[model samples]
Target: MNKIVYTLLIFLIFNHNFYATNYYVSNNGNDNNVGTIDSPFKTIQKAADIMSSGDICYIREGIYREEVIVSTNNLTFKNYQDEKVIISGADLITNWLPSDIGSNIFEASFTGAETQFSMLFVNNKRQKMARWPNNETDEMMMPEDVKTGYEDCQVFNTRSGKNGRRVKFPNLSGFPVDHFKGGIFRGIVGKKWINPMGIIESSNDTELTVTAISDDWGTNSSKMFTDNGKGFGFIFHLNALDQPGEWFEENGKIYFMPPVGKDPNDMVISAKNRKLAFVLNNRTNIKVDGINIHAASIAMKNTNNCEITNGSVQYLWPFFTRKGYAVSKTEQGGIFIDGNENLFKNMYIAHSWGHGIFIDGGRKNKIENCFIDNIGWIAQFTSSIQNFGDGTIVTKSTLGSSGRFHIRTNNKIDITYNDLYDCMKMGQDAGSIQSTNGGNWGVPLDLKGAEIAYNRIHDCNTLTDGNKEFVLALYLEGCFNYTVHHNLIYNFKTDVVPDGTFVYLGPRMATIKDCYYYNNTVWNVDWGLRVWNRENRGDVENILFWNNIIDGKANDGETSDNDRNVNSLLAKLSFKTNIRNITGNGNALFVDANQGDFRLQTNSVAIDGGTEVSGITDGFNGNAPDVGAIEYGSSFPDVGSNIDPEDISFELISDSSTLSTNSSDLKKESIVVYPNPSNSLIKITNLSNNYIEKISWKLTNLNGRELFTGKALTIDISSLPVGVYFLTVNKTKTFKVIKN
Candidate 1:
């Protein structure tokens, strides 16, 4: 522990990369053996403890049910040679016994010392907890799955500091109310957010009382679902555990009702006792690859320059943290990077009541090509990714689910070339990509920079109470100084908030000012733009709207100026009365608006009709700036993420025609099917555009027989006869090639 000795140890540790050691951990090995590939260590931690910089741990196949924390820097942890390695936070439950609860019911004593468990996994599948509106299928919290609606409840006898708020549910409810004294109240409680869950302190047939902590809100009978509506929630008790695949915990015992009609004795039942499978506790330059993590998460706390790719994290349930939504190991399901310059790419994340990838601090972190969906299905405060920091970027990713997109905290981010769909699938009062910022509340302030461009957001149709609910693709509240351009938004628009809209800018509690909105295309929606100043006590000023196209047959002609390009659904851009500081025109013409193409056409009125901004219109194709996202004559860049599992680096094919422009003056086409005389297979290659997996390709013989079809990054025609074949991209452009 002396100064010179410690400094010398640090020097040797940092320089150990020159003679890096290769350690191994296998389920079949022992810890006493040397850390070799043959005589591997029994646990991953055994290698992690002795490893310094540049040490590699090759984890062998099989599930290791333990939490491994790596505090060493410049380390590599990966599976050994395509072996299926799983780090699980769950322990196998073998001693299942019959329970007196009912027939086919079984109970197991709590063996782990964790005191409470949130998830019960049967053969790696998560089971539903005991509650009313029983999760009938894997469909999540769909409206039909739960018929319970908000009731005329009241919140009173409110106490601060964990006593929470006491709510009374009236209307003379039936059932033994005293037996549900300790049940939980899980409800939306009038707000789209805010899942006020608490224990039932006292109850009677006339009114059941429950307590919810936090002063987020308090409600009254007439105010249920209203602004001040406090009594808008439902309750569930342990006594309601009567469905298949349902389980509950009570008195330090775990109970289960077997799923798929399988007996507990015959199924691989496990309890999630450990919270995390891997913890990168303040380590740097580490890599975790090709490992499957079940019933746990990877918590990267305060680490930098780390990477997690080619992996997955599943079966993350609620790990409730007391006193605000605190960031901790308990609030993890997918990979979480809480540091700077970290990267999580090519990861598939699903099923959690938390964020898939949470950037808990302000730094330049990123998520690339990750397919994150089916998350936040349970309640509020969930998103596919939540960036609480500035300079965060999510690119080439497909994010969909019942939850929100990125949980914005007055933060700056770049959301480009991603596919977002099915947003607000089971929740409400939110947008697919939303930011509720600039309030008197103590959230972060002035996160005023977001580059939202080139993304495709659609199919945001979710139902509640058998009626279509309103969803927003881009909803920025109390936001300022943002640039939104070239993004394609469709289908996910609702005027219920005012008059129909695809993009919404609201001056809520804080001013919506100094934002540039231009070159965007909205189709199949009511209105292309909606600016609401319901909370206009704060100013709405300096909004620049330039070269936007709003089209589609849904709004054929609500007004005269609403041409096929400017559909008069709510007069193009619906602005609240007396709140119009917006400048620039929101009208334009498209090449083929009927087919959802927003590119400008020759002789269109939009050409040279707009102003020129510095960075945006620098590479204009026409005299000035044309209308809409893509320029009329310019080559189209690919939109959305390529989430294909088989994607990799392919040698770029040389084709001069693929780089051509689309204008009449250009001689060549912008996109082309390469290698006109392919030997076995051909690739539809575009030099200018990003790699797109959903770029459809179809192969057919001259006889009109379809040889190959479906979404393709590349098609294999090596098995076909040596003849000329027709290849189509998106069924719009067709090219001929020979399979020799």
Candidate 2:
């Protein structure tokens, strides 16, 4: 009975451990077991190894020197303390050999400013040490410890102030050496300065190759070198340096250096490709919230059905050299969504080397309330490579197949209420959000059934100097069934150039209606809106431009004919050009000489002045519809309500006959309320138009709870909230009620 009781207790404990497992990883303990809270693992990799789907690996605060790769499908790797969890490289060289005759052999430098001391040496060969005579006198006396006495000495170069000199040597093994080069013989002229220069470059695995080197005999040596001998060099040994470091390797993965520091912008000394800081690859129903991802390259890609909300992504720009030319271009981003059906909301993505949030070849996505600034590219999607030329090259086309295609047709895309500012360049083969001449490169082929409304797009032009005309406010082409309305676009100007233009609309049919363009101002631009239909197939029809206020005063002073081209297109189409109600100083319209046939109708109110169509009933305003977006007033009823206070009655009049009741003799009076269903504040002006003493008012909700009770000819209703209410007024001799 005792043994059975013990067995049952052990079984229950094991079951409890299996069901409630919360792994923890810190900078202590062996990284081999299931990382529990008490018996925790040392590294994040160990925690990941034992984590299954729906498992959480909570990491403690410390700088970890390992590239954590997540192979599990649905596991999370997060930090507990919200501190910096740095996974960096090892910093020590393991296998090293010391040589006495250090002529061709490069040794580590002791100078603190030298950044080349941490390099690793490969293809080390054994060679015999040679020694010279110690002195001219005392020839019979032999030097003790020959390897340390005279064999290790070499011609050392010392710099005093701005000058440097080379003098021959000391003989010591494993001693500190300054600026030593690698080769065959020490103190020899040809091989003295044969140290190999360390090379660091980035390339794919397909470009890796091995080559053989030649010795002094002109024969092919057995020693092989990598591409350009990049990884083959001698660096300062660890013990000779000021900072003590260690080389850590676990599970066949070697880490070569520690993290530079806790700061994400600190430079890292490594050669291996780092694992992504954040990855969203082929995932479905995944959501990441409120993460601050900074200083990462090639961060995220190939994700699907993921939502990233309330996050910040910033890249650190580092100086680099390419073909001996100094260049600085950081490659980092926030969330890179490549799959389909993702949502990003309320995110602040800035200071990225690439786009803030790059969406490539995805369908049915929604990006709302995002603040994107100081990024390379704002938002882009394309279908044609030719249209995306002269921008960032995201993907290149190959033989027998076109390049990357968006192919996302009718995908229910919504870009609303976003603040896009100061996003400069697009990625490789990808144009800026306004580039691509309206996303005509990738698949989906068209922006069919998309909505770009209620956004604030300003000051995004003039990022590139060469193509000032490339700047655009809102560009659309090859898209159908799209709507751009209710947006605030202003202060979009091009850089100073002769050919700079703004707002390019290509050969596509679209509806641009109800967009309140207040101060849609431009500077140094050739035209405000350049609508060019090259196809000439009349496919660009039913393109409406309604209620747009364009202010292009800067370009009005130009003597060139470019301004005439835009007005000519408007005239040729007999398109609606409503210029009325404008309160600015500039040329209203400029038509070309050859396009005289296109004319505004006489007395057509749209010529120099437009009829007031704001409150008109008919959709089309006059006998001839106004040329522009806004039409002249017509006999049709306007859009707003026509409140007739006299028509509203609360009287119990006769149903069988339109019998009369005297205005003043009636015991009960009919009350009328104007502007019923009011927004925040309601006005209850009496239609009786007569002064009566002591008019009492009461307002009640459906539950009959009195919301307001007051007595006045006109009451202050600024404090009332939004809802339905009943208003009752009592006169001295009559009682009347109304609904609001």
Candidate No. with top lDDT: 1
Q: Could you tell me which residue pairs clash in candidate 1?
A: 219-230, 223-229, 495-499, 495-500, 562-566
Give Cα-based local distance difference scores for all models.
0.63, 0.34
Candidate 1 residue-wise lDDT, 238-262, digit = tens: 6767777788877878888775445
TM-score of 2: 0.43
Backbone clashes, candidate 2: 49
Overall local distance difference test of candidate 1:
0.63
Residues 433-532 of candidate 2 have per-residue lDDT tens digits of 3322233422212444455544444443432222222444454433445555434344444455433333444443232222222212232333455554
